[model samples]
Target: MLWLYLHFPHLLLDHIRRTREETGALVIVEGSGQKVIQACPEARDQGVHGGMRLKTAISLVPELGTVRADQQQEARILEDQARWLYRYAAHIVLVPPDGLMAEIGSLQRLYGGLPAAWQTVEQALDERQLIAWPGLGHTPLAARLIARAGKGECTDDKGHIQRTLGQMPLLAAEFDARTCTRLQRLGLNTLGEVFALPAAELARRLSPETLARVQKIQGTRPDPQAPWQPPHHFRQQADFVQEIEQSQGLLFPLQRILAELEEDLCWRQQETDSLLLVLQHRHEEPSRLRIRTSGPEHRAEAFLNLVRLRFEQHPLRAPVMSLQLSVKRFLGREADTGQDLLGESQDLNEAWHTLMSRLQARLGDQALQQLSPQADHRPERAWTASGVQRNNRPAATMNDQLPRRPLWLLQGPQPLTEAPTAWFAGPERISGGWWDGQRVHRDYYIAQLHNGQLAWVFRDVRDGWFVHGWFG
Candidate 1:
């Protein structure tokens, strides 16, 4: 099996740097806060390096930023990276503290070739602003060793992998100090020399575990790895080295997260109707913004636009230290919306959704209302207000087959003082509301008034003629 190993030498520092807008000297200090364990390029330029005392690093760059290393946090970040790599390869093995390994043998045909697969992962790392060393080998152990030793290269040839592994220094093989000391006494300086020894004699000299490690690296033994599986729901977060005081500042990181979400949805062949955005603060409670679409949506732009509108409406309550976007509600795949024969989307539904989403965002959700037909026979109570939706009931379906009602209905019926100039279609009898307190018995007609306005006039059996409404 062909395995690809990615070594992150500065995962902790990279994790912290990605959230910052400015480039500065930065380093990750050990938990003791005495020695620097990892340093960025800017810090190296300022003469800071790993293993240097924190005070010494600060002496070089007085403005250096430092973050204490945490094993738990680093593992979580590593899993986050694994989550991203799982999109490309199915079989992934997490190497704690700094690395990830994936079996690409099964993906050769799917991604075209080894070069393409390597490029895909490399591109993702670049986009994520991460620093990694990638190595390829016939075994996971070999690939990981090559990557950690900084001898990584993209090649699947067994001969090349063997040669690269052979040249690795004894120390870079990750053997214990005692083993290295024993090998050094035997004048074995490189892996090539040690590997040249007879297997039986080598096994007799080395510990069982060390011998097994060597055999696994040389592909002489099987090294099975448990594959990593993504969680059922999607939740991605971004941390900021600098706190974001304004809502607009949060959008940059949010844009990247949303794009990742779009990719996740597309990969799953599904859509979602709702998203929950949580903004973590330094001292105050986190602010939660729930974004709901009119229909199942998968496009990143649509989500981003709605989020932007939401931010415009609600200002930030506190400075945000981190932001997380999650979608728990998974919806079925939407049908092909309005694609034409030419493959271009007619976008009727898309446009309608956009309009409704924007209006709901600008106006409160309750501000927009839809008119839905009710069972009432009274002209004024014939329709009720409903929430706006992507698919609205056709207006023609309301009161179908019934006598036409004027499009514009007056608040109350007015007494008709003057006679009608002409009478149009009319004489529709209406009687209802006995179940309630008020009962109505009338003969409604469409008549043209003296001012050329077509009015809805009704003669109440108990009262007199009254103008009820007007037709557009």
Candidate 2:
């Protein structure tokens, strides 16, 4: 099976630089913050290079920016890239700290050919603003070595792969310092010279571990790689080298992250109504913002707009150092039955949801309410106003022959000081609330008042008449 290995020389540096608008000198230092592990092109142009002492690097470029390396953060960034690559290949093995190996042999037919698959991955990397050296080989180890040596190619020829593997220096063979020194002392400089020696002689000269590594690279021994699967829920974080003092400064990074969420939801063929956004501060406690929609939505622009409204309503309490976005629950996407085949029809429900979401974000979650019909015979108890429902449920069926109710209703019955000038149609008896102890027995009618105003009048069993509501 053909394998594709990707080596990111400066994964951390690239990730940090992608969010910056300025092309300035930047370097990623070790945990101790004493030396540089990776440098960007701008830093290199300023005579800054990897392995340089941090003090010396800063001396060379006074404005040089440094971000300390984090094992957990690096792992998260690598996993994020792997999740993107998973779209092109199913079997992917993450070589932590800087590499990814994918088995693309089985995908040749699905992608049309090897070259097309190679180009697809390349384009995906470009779109994500990442840099990777990719290599193709018959074995995972072989592809990894070539990629690490900056000699990756797109060819799938077995002979060419072997020849490329043979030309690699012994240091690129992934051997320890002692083994490389021993091979050098034994007049072995390149992997090709070591391969020319007999297996027995090589085994006699090298330890069993080194010999096994050699056989693995040569494809004589099986190198089984455990496939990596993406997580079910989407959680991504964006860390900054410089503290962002303004809330507006966070949008640049949030745009890209929300777009990825859109893609993930689209891939799952689902939607989400809730998102949790956390803002880490320099001195203050982290702020947690829960942004919710009126209904299940998958559009990035819609989510971003809601977030913007939230930001306007609630300002940042402190300088943000990093931000994390997470979606814990997912909802199934329902088909848009309101539209036609040509998509010319406008979805009124979608528009209503958009408006409600905006108002909720600007005001508070508890500020808005939705009116729902209740199963009650009394007019006042027939409907209820409560929080908006996220999932759409089938509306209760109603008889078309039933008399219509007025939109405007009074708080309660009022004394009718004047008699009705005319009567429309009524005598619709609604008697219930017997179990609730608030029994009501009245005959309602639609009548016009003497002041030329339409009103709803009702009379009780004692013949006492009153105006209960009005007809708009």
Q: Would you estimate the TM-scores of all the predictions?
A: 0.77, 0.83
Model 2 earns a TM-score of 0.83
- Candidate 1 per-residue lDDT, tens place, 1-472, comes to 9999999999989877876767888899999999999999999987999999999999899999888888988888898899889989889999998999999988989899888988999999998899999988889999999999888887788898899999999999999999999999999999988888878788888777777888888989898888888777888777776678898888887888899899889988899988999999989989988898877889999999999999999999988888989999998886675774445564877787788888887787899898866778888778788887754333464445665778888888999989999998769888898899678889899999999999999999877999999998
* Over 4 Å off, model 1: 110-112, 185-187, 197-205, 332-345, 374-386, 392-472
Candidate with best lDDT: 2
Q: Name the TM-score of candidate 1.
A: 0.77
**Candidate 1 collision pairs:** none
How many backbone clashes can be found in candidate 2?
0
Question: What is the C-alpha RMSD, rounded to one decimal, of candidate 2?
Answer: 4.7
